[model samples]
Target: MTTLTIRRPDDWHVHFRDGAVLEAVLPHTSKDFGRAIVMPNLVPPVVTTADAEAYRRRILSALPDGHDFRPLMTLYLTETTDADDVEKGFRDGLISAVKLYPAGATTNSQSGVRDVARVYPVLERMAEIGLPLCVHGEVTDPDIDIFDREAVFIERVLAPVRQRFPALRIVMEHVTTKDGVDYVRSQAENTAATITVHHLIINRNAILAGGIRPHYYCLPVAKRESHRLALVEAATSGDARFFLGTDSAPHPTHLKEAACGCAGVFSSINAMACLAEVFEAAGAMDRLEGFTSLNGPAFYRMEPNTAEVTLVRRPEPVAYPATVPFDGGAITVFDPIFPIHWECVPAR
Candidate 1:
């Protein structure tokens, strides 16, 4: 129980911004995860096969020397997305999935789809090619309360899409509510979800309570403790439909501390340590591999990693860096506010 070796995990969701931010945070994830599904919501967004291929090159080029990391690229779904281009990227192995942002659902998502029906052609093609569509399941309606968006998204958006494309694979990215968990479970096939490390640990109080802590703020913001417990239970339950996706987004300290702060949690640096503690405390340490490493590949229909990484539980808490500095600014790391004893032994 003190030392666990499992196939290196893959992050089902991550945002590696271009240039300095990309260089700064890419290694934090690459060091621990064998691969990650790179989100395409950049300033301009990656909507074409050519954009994905170019972004892939930037990720590989920014990858630290000696670190073996594969960036599973995805296309940002827009109303005008070409089915031919999407299929071409999926067929050529350049794109692992397509992303649905739901127009203004989160950061850098103004270019997202305003009307779901406008993208039915692209969704139909994706289902035919067997490509998974990763969704940021939330509504952008100004009337909907922030806490209620995810649940409403299910009732109003995702359910309708499912009825239209039953066979299309879908991943509800960074799910934060009990409703989300129930919906993912309701689907018998072609559906799964990615749970973020922050959601399993923090709640709305983390942001609204004790003044306003911008660092803890994220879109589809963390819900109440009841929902947190639901996410914890779902993640620890060892379900194939549920797996790890850190959603390890990085934003500069200045932007995060501003009047209008950004929405993201940078947890890539110590995500494994956090997950190890969360799973261990739940008395489900044995199922860690299934949640972190095994189930993800099964859902993605790929082979688990051939390489192994060992996490050893030390006698005392390990201190992870508080901030990582890039060229223009520094990005803060997520603090789980719990003891972290697990450390990955460096590969030889």
Candidate 2:
């Protein structure tokens, strides 16, 4: 098969934790991506314009020397989030979007919004100002079955919000099910979804494929194989409504291997490699560029990156780091669906 070359891609969603973990993982993402919208779910969360600006600066500082990677910053929406503040941040270009993580939805997410209606005023303001609301799209209610959260959220929360504020731009982040794909497809405008590399390559089976593989776990956790097929079709369809976002969350290795392992798939190391395999298998390698590089910027009304990057088809197994040594411990990297035999060595 011939190698594929395209404009350098941008990651619509990414979580680069602060300090050393950020330092270790940022390089993998920067190497493959032109830019990435940095998630703001730090311990305290980036709640204000000033916080976002400072966080952006830190990300810039963390970038490997001589790399032009840009970290697009975002604001973490909370009960106390002020609409004026959000608007000011966007106007000043300090932030690109506001993230809504329903409380208890995922890691370091307890600080998330407890009630979506309570944040309606904030969403209204975002809609008025043309800033998109990026959401985790899952119900935190313990009563909701883990596998049904995304579908249920669409019915109980997202659908209602879309009706209430049809003008608001919304990105259903890291969508993991067929329902999510259908939902995003049904809404042609003003709404879109980001498909993660891990979700695209694996399914709920990966988490328990041979046995319980904690590293394969993540929130809105991987769904069934049929759901995975739907994701592949949507992503490779060249539809502007779908785009790339690694959601490459990293946790200390110990945390991931514990009795109650944390939720997040650390895919930064082989994100493009994984995507290449998926697209190639689906015979949609021709559409990889738009999914990886163009759609996200188009949806956000931003410029697609000017730089170009290439992915050649070469056989190389992606090695999993048992742990990425950081401050006091190490962060575990998930074993991708298969040993990624096709490596994506960047052509500068």
Candidate 3:
């Protein structure tokens, strides 16, 4: 139990923002994950096959030497997205999935789909081609309570889409609530969910308890302690429908600590360590591989990595870097509010 080795995991969801930020953070993820589904919500966004191709090139160029990592590109779903282009990208193996962000749902999401109905044509084509749709899983209604968005989104938006296109593969990204867990469980085999490392550790208390802690704030924001417990149970339960998607978004410390702070948690640096701590505490360390490595590929119809990573439980706590510097400012790393004794041993 002190030393454990498993297939190198893939981050089913991640945001590698372009330029210096991308270069600064890409190494943290590539160090452990073999592949990552790169989010397309850049300043202009990656909406076409060409855009994805160009971005992929940038990611590969920024990758540190000797790191064997692949960026699984995706198209940002917009009302005017072309189905022909989408299918071509999927067929050519340039694109892995299409992201659906409800307009204004999160950072850089203004160009997202405003009306879900407008993108039905694209969804229909994706269903036909067996391409997966990764969703933010929260409604953007002004009247709806912020904490209630995910559950309400299921009842209002996602449920109808599921009913309309039963064959469309959907990944409920960052399932933060018990309601979300139950919904993903209730669906047919076509449905699965990605659980983030931060959600499993922190709840709303981490954000609004004593004072405003911006680093803990993220869209589809953390919910009650009960919801956190539900997510922990689901992740540790060894369910194939649930797997890792760090959503390890990096925001510069200046922006993150601003008046209206950005929503993201940069956990790529210590994600594996954090996960290992959770699993070991739950007495479910054996199931950690399923949550981190196996289930995601099974759901996406991709093969699990043959390479192995070993984590060793150290007598002293692992000290991950506090900040990663970029050109202008530094990005903060996620702190689990706990000491992590497990560290992933580097490949020799």
CA lDDT of each candidate?
0.93, 0.88, 0.95
Backbone clashes in model 3, listed as residue pairs: none
Q: TM-scores of all models? A: 0.99, 0.96, 0.99
The best candidate in terms of TM-score: 3
lDDT of 1 at 250: 97
Model 2: residues with Cα > 4 Å off, grouped in runs: 315-323
True-structure RMSD for candidate 2? 1.4
Ranking under TM-score, best-scoring first?
3, 1, 2
TM value for model 2: 0.96
Residues 1-348, model 1: lDDT tens digits: 898888888899999999999999999999989989999999899999999999999999999899988999999999999999999998998999999999988989999999999999999999998999999999989999988999999999999999999999999999999999999999976899999999999999988887999989988799999999999999999888999999999999999999989999999999998999899899998898999899999989999988888889999999899999999989999988777999876544
Cα miss at 325, model 2 (Å)? 2.6
All predictions: root-mean-square deviation over Cα?
A: 0.9, 1.4, 0.7
Candidate 3: count of backbone clashes, pairs at least 3 residues apart or interchain = 0
TM-score of 1: 0.99
Candidates 1 and 2: which is better by lDDT? 1
Clashes of 1: 0
lDDT of 2 by residue, 201-247 (tens): 88887788779988888998888999999999999998899999889
